[model samples]
Target: MKLPGIKGFDEEALKKYFKNTGMLLIGKVGSLAIKMLSSIAVANYLLSYGNGILTTSVSYVFLFAALAGLGLDQFIVKELHQYPEKREQILGTAFSLKSFAGLICIPLIYVAWLIYPLEGIKYSHIFLLSFMGIFQSFTIIDSYFQSEVKSKYIMQVQIIGNLVSAAIKVGLILMHSSITFFFIAYLFDTILLSAGYIITYNRKGRSIFNWKYDFSLAKKLLTLSWPLIISGIMVSIYMRVDQIMLKQILGDKGIKEAGAYNTVVMFSEALNFVPIAIVSSLFPAILNARRDDKVRYQKRLQNLYDLMVWLSLSFAIFITIASPIIYKLYKPEYISAAPVLSVHVWGSTFVFLGVASGQYLIAENFGHLSFIRTGLGAIINIVLNILLIPTMGMMGTAIATVSAYFASAFFILFIPKLRQQGIMMLKSLFLVTAFQKIFKR
Candidate 1:
């Protein structure tokens, strides 16, 4: 049962397939540019300490959001593809579960606030941000759209929401609003995005709440999602712990410095949309290939890996060279962040590879293994931060991040099957380039 437009089965069709993929990439890049501009405005207006508080609060919210939804986003996406006819049911189950969890999270957040009283206004921001999880759960419907490769609508929604948010933030800053306005802007942006998704789904005559509750579906989703929950939590730890630890180790001043560094750090992260958008577009194709033909499945995976490596490497080099200039352009306060960004941006290359590999694991239903690997990396990150941050400060955090990413990428390549896959990836690199030359001729 071949999918409607898979090209590997027909070598002559490869050019068309690649062309379409390039188009998708262009759209994704456009959307990412808008997002990057929005982020820059927020960063510039907030400065370092203000941005640190905002960053820390958002990180904490993400941690709780990952836990509250229990990884249902991934679970629903994977399961829905298997039963496209039951897209509504799958989304309904995911939506119901996530909504309940979101409700439950409110109380839990209050309790967490009590436990960590120092969070103060940060706690309120995290609680407000939790809606992003509930809003994210609505993405089950978007997954349905993605499974069919209808990405334009979702892309447009994202671009519009971001533009609106950016406009509001800029307006607020020009009016000399408080830092708290930034959080309010974020909340408003998410609400508008969620509404857009919901309205789109409704117009398509689909509802995430259409199916009745099914205990069996709930159990299955939980079984699949629990490991993801652990993995997501650990990923949060690795990604956020540096900031949290910086706060603890460096106090308020350190937090501000870390935040300044992160401003530069996130500019590198802007390149992340390329790999992410590609992976998202490619997953269903990969899954379908896996189901239909193992040889082609492996071949496609190899091609994907090769492309990822090239893209990641190019971006890393460009950012490394451009970091100092970028930091100066942003503000003089961020000049100290140039060295930190150079080291940290290189980590993005490895992190992109790790993300690509993790997608393979997810497509293969090996989420638990993915979790274990990331968990190990997270542990390494925590230990390094503790030992290095006090003595080396922000530079230490940058070093630890790159080190952790390298360790994780290394571990992924060590899996027996992945080792063989890695070799295929290398071979595919030569073949893809050779084929491109032939096509040009």
Candidate 2:
């Protein structure tokens, strides 16, 4: 049952690992491919700055959506893993909480709309896109499936939605559709994901109609998840607030700067799936290890740590080298994005470690520590952005992002409670132990 390359994994576990990661990898690659093509199309059509309008619109929604989710995606998974018999109540409460959060955040989203440089697009376009999160609230279903390692179903849903969205973008290109429509396509994709998740859930012989809300369950979920919500908000800010700051700092020319950085950031983030897909499949296994076998849990976690570091380090080097070529593939005006890409892409290293560590924190009930680490990153990012943007522009924002990610992922590892995870990350970052293991083997 043992695997050849990946150590410490049995046959069935290894099979499920491949099955889950394979589906997720396929979905992520497909989604990223389509999105890049779409971005290229937008760049050609709208130019970099006008494209900024589109990027900024979606960024707003992302920030708001993070707030709207209440950080229960992982909570639902943890709950389901611990209590499968309570699936109906757990999911029902999750969905209602998400819906309520979404509705409550909409008004705040609207009040802040006019602040964005919408180019020629209407505020209403951004407004409509914001509501996509409410529908997305139903994606609690994905968490349920993820806990069960049935991501193939989720993959099917995502792949279908992405294909349809890509087709719409192609049609938009054929018709020389307004840039506004491209942004609309983005919203449509969100809708499709929700629809697909719901359909897949029904086909699996479940109904939301049977999903009954338990107030007590909801309260527990909320209490357990509040730190995650805060952490999510901080992480969201550290990630997206830069784009907004770019607009504010640059004056009339700001949107273009923001847009250019957006593309580079997107390119950098595309490969993030390497870690995410792997972690998603491995998380349930790690959590179960905590219950059944502590030694196996720590060993497996270490192996994962090594793997994440190696993958992220390799990708960071590759992107730094290819930044110019990657940017030139877009448009001439986008060349400035090359430096941004080089600097920004390095964030992926810490991001990978951070993501992997997040699963462990949840499994070990250190969500509050996770939140504190995230808050430190957010504070650092905001302060750095403010100080650097006026002088360094987009590249400044890139620097801030990288530094923030490092603080969150690596810097706080100096703390005692988190020292073990920090050590694992450092090993992955430096490859000290990973190399030793390889040579010894």
Candidate 3:
């Protein structure tokens, strides 16, 4: 049967799309489950202070790793789709660029560490995780698989990696291992995933050795991707800077505060994979609609926004109600995170809308706009953290996160060309779209 509003997609194609998305969703959900259970164990084992140290170190490394990626994955997939024969050049140049950036990042990270140091976090943790960027260069191959619509392979690699990583963490807990061992296990997670990607690619009868880099192609890719690189950095800031700021701003209580905040964040952001899986599976179809039919294109985009709003809103509501009980699973000290989770979970609604609309931005080549919005968000988050943390504590950080995400996602409205989309998203958020459907039916 033809689904209402999705006019252009036939039944068979829809099946294929959902099947692919379902496979990825299952992998992500399964991995999330493993990580959640193991993370809870680790959190309880380490308690607030130890968890705070770990969260701070990971967030710190993550900010620089964003730079090392060069923001080439989306463009690589786009290039591969448009010119399949240039696969080698696209992948090769992307890998080469990322690898160089990865190498440069280590020294740059060292310099950064020297400039702004976090209390309770060791430079050794930063040094070890910096190498994750190098191993992550293999993730360019992940884009290749995505372009080929072979996310199952990527899913396999992720599940295997998470499983192994979780097992290692669990083993360490059993062994009564030191915190340093957990950091090493974290690095091993990236190394193992990169290895899986290489093995999967090779098993498919492709040789990484055949990939060759072109200087001109490098220039072209960089020119096209520079905006994304900056925007990605901005995104990293808003997403991660909270914990860093919490750790730094509070001084004596920083680590424990960060720990509570990080615990709630893991819970709130866990379901983020839902939107990503749906969007990635349906992205090609949306692009095809944009090419073939404008009306259908708008309909599909509206439908996607509507789905995101409902899914995320429901999640937020559920978490809001259940957060207190959820905290019971943790130690008593983490009970403070319960209220924060209730507040932070609402941010996912905007996050879901943002992820869906972000695809539209990429498809329309409004890369700079992404940078502007995300940059705005980073500024907002930083300012709020500085202002609120001293007075309101972790709850202040939660409020700031939600507000920044809302501003970033809806910033499109100020641009006349994209105002229609912003309005469409509003309709979904307000249930105007659902009411319209009900009335029509």
Candidate 4:
């Protein structure tokens, strides 16, 4: 099937990428539907208070889990493309680094908890989920498939994983398991996915056992990825800290409030997979354009920005309109999330743009700037959450989130090297680029 033309991009490359991206999107769309239904069911069963506990535990681990990832996936894909013969070494080094970091993250999570514990969340819940960082080491297998442009395999794994995960949640609901079992189910999801990655890799005639760690390569990767590590932490902070803060600031009813907020996020953030699928599937093409043609590279980047803007804007508009009806799927207490969803859904337009620009940053080797932008956003989000939540409640948190997303995604406007790219995004965001493309055709 022919994709509608993007005009300036190489037609052949666009077709190839569209096919690859289409596969990922197909898989993600299926998984998104399954996960959303199961997630709402889980939320309805757990109610606001229990979900508050779940959200806090997951968010807390996610902060430290940033350290566990060490920001190696992008570099891993780049390395594998440039040096396919070194695939084993690259995978091995990354897995070793991530596994070690994941181990350290456990203790770090404990220390952070001790210093400033989540008010009503249990250590057991956090402790169980902390292993997710370690299990995530297996995701290096995912980087391998992405480098090969074999997202179909990754998609298969995601669909199967989500299906099984949804089934487990359904089982828990039927058996009327305690909140603790849900925590186990969460951890099991990571474990199951990791196992899936390994099996898929082996089926593709690749053996995880053949991967070899090299200290020198590990050092090189760390040198390149450290900024991203810090940036990942910062990204996590801005993206997730609000829910954490929500529970803390609201006093006696904080957990219930966080629970209601989680419902809104579940609906809003589910669509994030769209950007990830598009960006990941096209990244190698973007990198090739950078190596081969500067003008084409710029045009492709702009086209990507254009696509991100329109797709996210359309979804946000739909969700904003339908949020009230969407919340009808949830328990009555979650009714407040309907309005918050309307506001919070718009943040995704920036998020989509951010995902696309983030790849541009990696391609341009402007890694340090990534953390700087994210750090600024994190600080803004935290301050806004503090100032707004008390008076504005969940609505304040939504405003803060959308504001932070826009600021971080667009802050490159002030950087000399990044200014042009920022302008391209602005044109896309405002539909100037889209209009120009249409008129030119």
| Candidate with the greatest TM-score versus the true structure | 4
Give a tens-digit lDDT track for model 3, residues 1-441: 322334345577578777888778888888898889889999998989999998889999889877899988888988898899999999999999999999999999899999998877889988988898899999998789878877888888888888888899999999999999988988898899899999999999999999999999999999988888998999899999999999898975989989888889999999998988888788888898899999888888998898888889889999999999999989999998899999999999999999999899998989778889999999999999899999988999999999999999999999999999999999989989877776786
Model 4 quality (TM-score): 0.97
User: Residues 356-415, candidate 1, lDDT per residue (tens digit)?
Assistant: 777888777777887787788899999999999999888898888888877776675677
Score each candidate by Cα lDDT: 0.72, 0.82, 0.89, 0.89
Q: Candidate 1: count the clashes.
A: 0
| lDDT (Cα, 0-100) at 135 in candidate 3 | 91
Q: Which ten residues in a row have the lowest lDDT in candidate 4?
A: 1-10
Q: Clashing residue pairs in candidate 2, if any?
A: none
Each candidate structure's TM-score, on Cα atoms with residue i matched to residue i, is 0.88, 0.94, 0.97, 0.97
Per-residue alpha-carbon lDDT of model 4 for 102-128, expressed as tens digits? 999988889999998987778988899
Lowest-lDDT window of 10 residues in candidate 3?
Answer: 1-10
**Model 1 error, position 140 (Å):** 1.6
Query: Higher-TM-score candidate among 1 and 4?
Result: 4
* Model 1 deviation from native, Cα RMSD in Å: 4.3
Off by over 4 Å in 3: 1-9
Off by over 4 Å in 1: 1-27, 117-122, 208-211, 422-441
Clashes of 4: 0
